[model samples]
Target: MALWTMSFLLTGCVIKQHQSLSFCETASPIYISRDDVLTQETKRQILAHDVVGERVCGWGRSNHTS
Candidate 1:
């Protein structure tokens, strides 16, 4: 019983750490195109909704190559 409890606690801690690490690793800057026809107000709302608690690193047009 004691071993099972210890294992459960360790598993929970590992899962929590993994989630945080993954969030940081995947939190890259998002690019928004000027040609998308999005108003400033609309853009702010979209970013706020998508990013939630995370800070946006940067925003601008994404360069594309043919």
Candidate 2:
């Protein structure tokens, strides 16, 4: 009984995996480049609430931090 149930569950997972691949094929492409990203000046003015001095996400300091 357990073996039969396991096989049924595995077959359902395989079918869902094929469907996911088809969905991905119809999705739009994403382009990411340094130039396409925002500049420091724009970030300061637009994302002021999220910015604190020069720290962003506890990573590096901003250009004005020094």
Candidate 3:
């Protein structure tokens, strides 16, 4: 019973957040989390990764192929 309860809570918080893959892909970092206090770090990490990935992708696309 205890294990089931713990699993349910964990699933609600972490798994539920990612279930919406479309939301994750389309939503900006600002819309990632509604609770500022709880998701500040998560938002920061996501934003940093997105910025770096976009920069790298842009650079790759512009680099000389010949």
Residue-level lDDT of model 1, residues 1-66, one tens digit each, is: 999999999987774434345444565444456567888997787676446425443333233233
lDDT of each: 0.57, 0.47, 0.52
The sequence of per-residue lDDT tens digits that candidate 2 reaches over residues 1-66 is 999999999988874434344423343323234555777985656445334322424323323221
CA lDDT for candidate 3:
0.52
lDDT at 31, model 1: 49
Report residue 41 deviation for candidate 1 (angstroms). 4.8
Best by lDDT: 1
What ranges in model 2 sit over 4 Å off? 15-66
Per-candidate TM equals 0.29, 0.23, 0.31
Note each model's CA RMSD in angstroms: 7.4, 11.3, 14.7
> Which ranking of candidates, highest TM-score first?
3, 1, 2
The per-prediction tally of clashing pairs is 0, 0, 0
- Give candidate 2's root-mean-square deviation (CA, Å): 11.3
**Local lDDT at 63 for model 2:** 31
- Model 3 misplaced stretches (Cα beyond 4 Å): 1-38, 59-66
